[model samples]
Target chain A: MTADVQTLASESGCHLFSGCGFPSPGLNVFEFKPIFSIGAFDFTKPMLLALISMLLVIGFFWSAFAKPKMVPRGAQNVGELGYLFVRDNISRETIGKKGDPYVPFLFSIFFFVWVMNVMAIIPFAQFPATSRIAFPASIVGIVWVTYLVLGIKNQGFVGYFKNMMFPPGLPKAIYFLLAPIELLQGLITRPFTMAVRLFANMFAGHMLIVTFSVGAWYLLGFHIGALYSATSFIVVVVLTAFELMIQALQAYIITLLAASYISTSLEAEH
Target chain B: MDGAAWSSVGYLLSGMLIYGGIGWLIDRWTGHSALFLPIGLVVGIALALVLVFVRHGRSS
Candidate 1:
């Protein structure tokens, strides 16, 4: 019940890398140690979690898709549905006809995030890698590079900047202000916002579960505590369901944004 | 419960702002998102380092 969330909150930070504690030495007592780091490469617990998530997602789907059947069943159906869902909703809709070539890339991003988010509320392994900003930022960075390079590759230097800077339908008089705003937004805000969106959601979600779970534990002590404790039990139950919904929503959002980038590029410049 | 007792919200918020701020700066300069990959790792570690020093600095 409260065990998994607790494990994640406690274990994630300190198991590897070293850091400071909260509430002081004998009080708040929370510190995370660095697992290992070089220049910018730190292998921490969450890093391991991220690796496992990628491996698990790829391995399971690979097995499922490895042997196709006339009529898909069990894991194969589940895996295929996951892939098809991204293909139809995200790739097809956002990028439209031109986005077909990117189906595999879109599918990987969607399903990978989908599975990582699913890990959070699954009882024993109640952890979400995206809760670590580094994790989501990495993916966002990758996606940003892909579209950015493509935008430049296809449109060329001045053309790519022009396309991103000035979208199709804008007042000519305002292109000066709007162009810088657009360029800046793409360069600075877009990927960070993308990473933070997923990171903030998962980070907040897991923390809520942990806080309330701990609150419930402490509450079981007496009359008020017990009453609040029992109430929290119910709250956790309801929140868990909502959290699952948010998990899927986050994955969809990431995939949708990726496809939208492609679609925007394909449109004729204004 | 692992290290300190600060509000989780405070730590997370600070992390978000600092990491985002630093990442933004790197993006502006390098024009490469890869610049952030290592930077985040550094900032997170640096944050931890600061935490270790801040409390210890006060304690002594």
Candidate 2:
């Protein structure tokens, strides 16, 4: 990664400001060298960002709810609003009334993902940790396991598969054609799409931002290119605003889907 | 409701992937070019449609 950066730097002849050539950002931007290593463990920028996001989520909620107030003031008031947002808007809307029990799970996933994505636009920390596939993949893995367990526990092992694969009103002969597809949908594609959806959104948003930001800075070098540079800078601003909406929407959709999956698992039949 | 809709999409994708994947393997084995690939893909889409309609389209 550093080697590519060096090549671009020399190619442009821009050690600080030497040429008007635009040096495009690529996959190398995503890879970060470890700051420090303890045995097999290596701490990198995204890892640190992810850790900070987790801490921010925990700290914010803990501060807001540690001491409950009768009338609610300051942090408690803000905390209640967030709580209700997840409960009423997401859980109740998607999973129905009984989804209240899973509100905490949904709330955590939503806020954690939101904060991680929002990091992309933050001034100093401009990279979204969720852009890395591992984060979303791991979270979806947990979600997958949670719903699968919930289904098996609520219905007997055989009953769970029976209900899932054999929906009523289907012809007997069609079962052979449908069962494998249904099983794949339930067992594999559900989680696969969940992970990819979040990862792809963040990944593409970050890349777009980098492309414009680099173009703007690169074009600023020549007097003749200044007008185009300003145009690129304007695009960067617009894209940043768009990224904010996408970040929040992706978080909400993932949480909403998670709740829906849990609710489906708890059902006696599909 | 949204879950059912997304589940429909998931069904279609996975069905095509699984069967189309099998067809690709068959084509490779026999060196028959593209004979089973389209067949697999159509069958996959058809089965996925049936699964979606049964699961989400019908009124219980």
Query: Which predicted model would earn the best TM-score?
Result: 2
lDDT value for candidate 1?
0.66
Candidate 1, residues B1-60, lDDT tens digits: the string is: 211222222333344455656677778788886678467646644553443344233444
Task: Give one digit per residue, the lDDT tens place, for model 1 in A178-251.
Answer: 44435545565566667888888988887777666655554555355577778978888888888999999998
All candidates: TM-score of chain A: 0.84, 0.92
Give the Cα-based TM-score of candidate 1 against the true structure: 0.70
Q: Which candidate is the best by lDDT?
A: 2
Candidate lDDT (C-alpha), each: 0.66, 0.85
- Clash pairs for candidate 2: none
